[model samples]
Target: MIIRSALTRSLIPEFLTGAGRNQREIASALSSSRREFLRNTAGLVLGSTLSGASPFLRGESVRKKRKVIVVTFGGGARDQETFAPEGQENIPHLLNELVPQSSFFTHVSNQGILGHYVATASLTTGVYETLNNFSAVAPEHPTVFEYFRKDLKRPASDAWVVAPSNGFNRIGESECRSYGPGTGATVILPKHLLAAATSGGAADFDHLLRDNYENPLYTPQLGGGEFELQQLDGILRLSVADFMAHARTLSSPDELSIYIAKRLMQQEAPSLLWITMHDIDVAHSGAYSLYIEGIRRTDRLCTELWNAVQANPEYAGNTTLFILPDFGRDSDYDAGGNGFQHHRTGDVASRTTWMMALGAGVREGVIFNDPMQSIDLVPSLGAIMGFSPAQSQGKPIKDLL
Candidate 1:
């Protein structure tokens, strides 16, 4: 099966160019002193490696690697609005319905900057970000992607990150190169790219932006060269066609990501995958009812993903799916309210989160009450993938085993 969907390819140029330039500018700005420059350069290199670096570079064999799917419930959400008993009505499908069938954690907290990207970084790196606001600096510590790809020597293509929020575009690439060699981590956002590729006049947007490269239309300018654009065009053509065709069968964007993910599993069969669904967080758009609808849609998407995994041989019995939010939002009764507003100021309810795991080798009907942190996921996933955690602060949640 050809894994290079037109949409995936078409977006590559834009994705790579944009991401590469961001790193380059960040590196140059911080390059005044050699020591600090090297540090920043290391971050840039690691980030690129995470984007598309291959695992063979690290001397690791790739055969029959266990498959993992991590779903991020991004944009802080309160427990009361989700799994918590009081807010159960708000998320009927998830809280009241999707109970602790597999290993489930109720008191999961993220002690970090309480913002979306910061919490997300902490979740994967197991280290808190000092600044709560937007961070340009990558995590100093290695991420789960690095450990799995380098330490385990898995294929770089075997890992992926798909987030709806453009804010997480730098996730895998940030701490990617700490492993020293051979890592196959590829972060992608099919929905974003698809929307950009299929939207009316996107080509015009690209053309106009190219017309004035010096004064780029967006915050980050695209770089590389014509070769990049050609390669990107080819990729986008294929990805767009596939996505448009798939849209007929899938109604929601979450479903589209899942469909693409399954396609990736069947074709590339990556050992680890991260998929984020963001409509719920669109609550910031000031549409509480729409946010709730997004939650319901997410619930349906989860069920569909579960069903798809069971039916697909690549994932079936060999895969484990861990689902949780990047961070929780404030309670409706609290300062920000739950519908569709900001989550950065740090509300007690926003820190509350939960996790669910299901699949082979995982205990079923297990409920964990102990206080757990998002950082713990990395170590637990590492252990599950048959590797020892290296200098990881997070502990493995033994109950899952």
Candidate 2:
């Protein structure tokens, strides 16, 4: 008899056995084996074909149903600028208009290294980073995505990350990639398609087919056309060939990404979806007037996304939208006059961020006064989605629930 390897055994915990006279010994044994089991179970749990077989795949009863949409206001904006009444007119649409109808967190703050990756990691994983750098690793705890996907037995591809730029390329090992129990596939910035199209590369169906053949995993689904395959390849080139054929009809890259997200929602919308808008970040190249214009465009994008969610049958009435920045720029009070230029040094303004929530299960027009950290988002999201916290460092905001 050939026993399964340790790695294999680690993934499937149901195969383990324990014997003890009392509860403590049994519990200890189970704990030791649990991590290994979950690790070994990844392949089967995240396998594309087996997605529908999971118990949690069954849609929730109408009364218990809820959806979660997390939007990173990538590239930070100051509270004084966005929500604080001091500069309320700067972001009039978001502040005076949106805040009144949605729940606002007046005391909310981000307590990380005051960097993009660090704050985003804290927001999703509910832990502070020891370092404030780009390549920083996400904490080794289950994220809001993992809690919903694994504990709830939802499909692996149900979770989504739609970024206009490379905003969410590092959500986590498990959250960013298709692995482990309840891990879902991610969609990254596929700017390559635009590059290819603009660079005079062939955009015809034949060229895409050839590319697919060279990589068998890229083979298009029966009904999905070549353009769809190209779009899927642009973001996730492996393990998602089934979505390619439908990509042809998308008019633009943004539209293509949103279409794909909507498709995933209809197929089996993972309980958790993260969307990042980065058009404004590109506008910060020393053009003050252009930067303000970018802000307006970002506002419109938010409105468009909200409209899409409302109009889309799959997400309407069932989703919760949480939007906030990843980090903020330097204070204009600096002597060197590096206003709105960078976020290098840690400052009071740089660490400050904002949050807003609307939709199912969230109290409308409520404002939370207690200070909350970005790490708190994961647990709060988990509680709202009917799951227990999974070894997170932050506490859930009871006010949000």
Report clashes for each candidate as comma-separated counts: 24, 18
Note the Cα lDDT for every prediction shown.
0.55, 0.51
**What lDDT score is found at residue 218 in candidate 2?**
31
Model 2 earns a TM-score of 0.65
Estimate TM-scores for all models.
0.70, 0.65
Query: Number of the top candidate by TM-score?
Result: 1
Error of 1 at 393 (Å): 2.2
Against the hidden true structure, what lDDT does model 1 obtain?
0.55
Question: Which lDDT tens digits does candidate 2 get at residues 1-401?
Answer: 11246443331122212222243332233323322222232211211112122112223574246678887765665433343333334565554445444665544556567655456656767777553243423345556666676666766555666644333344533434443333643544433333333342336432222221112233221121112334544434423434444445433334444554555555555557787644344324655554455455555456666677888777788878888777666656545436565665554455555577877655555544455677888888776676766667888876665
Which 10 residues in a row give candidate 2 its minimum summed lDDT? 42-51
Worst 10 residues of 1 by lDDT: 207-216
